[model samples]
Target: MDRAEFLNRLEAQLLDVPQAEREEALQYYEDYLNDAGDAGDFDILQELGTPEEVADSIRNGLRQDSSAAGERSGQADEN
Candidate 1:
């Protein structure tokens, strides 16, 4: 997808994340695009993967963090 389409899809998927975190993610992607653009790397999109895939990865990471936090809380309760 092109830059505009990529950003639009990314913003939609990031709706559930905190604003600051979402902005940080967006900024990182934006910088990646800029660097790729300067380096004549039009195929960077292929390496980054699809927006849906990236979003799913982010969601999975969040789920893992939540599960870990819950486990830690349970251990604290037992202590």
Candidate 2:
């Protein structure tokens, strides 16, 4: 798929995520694609995998970050 289609699919998959996070992810990918001027859409897709895969990665990363932040906050509270 092309960049637009890939981003659309990713946005659809990210519907359950918060708006700010979703937008940030989309913008990050958009910038990534723009920076890859030498690569074609297929190449980028191949490197990144499908939108579902990318969205899952983003979600997983967010979950890990959130968990870490919560743990830090809890430790601070206990101190």
Candidate 3:
């Protein structure tokens, strides 16, 4: 997918995430793409997996963090 489409899909996937975090992630990726473009890497879009794959990876990380926090809280309650 092209730059616009990639970013669009990413934003949509991030709907469930907080607005601040979502914007931060989007900015980071935008910077990444800009840097790659500066380096003449026009194929960066192809290199970065499809937007959906990237979003899934991000969502998985969020889920893992939430799970870990929940486990920690549960343990604390039991103590």
TM-scores of all candidate predictions against the true structure: 0.75, 0.93, 0.75
Worst 10 residues of 2 by lDDT: 36-45
Clashing pairs in 3: none
Model 3 clash count equals 0
RMSD to native for every prediction? 2.1, 1.1, 2.1
Residue ranges of candidate 2 with Cα displaced over 4 Å? none
Whole-model alpha-carbon lDDT for candidate 1: 0.80
Candidate 1 lDDT at 19 equals 89
lDDT of 2 at 47: 94
Writing each residue's lDDT as its tens digit, candidate 1 over 1-79 gives 6876887898899899878777888888888888778454458877877777777777788789899999999999999
Across 1-79, the per-residue lDDT of candidate 2 in tens digits comes to 7888999999999998999999999999999998887467679878999999999999999999999999999999999
> Best by TM-score, which number?
2
TM-score of predicted structure 3: 0.75
lDDT of 3: 0.83
lDDT at 21, model 2: 99
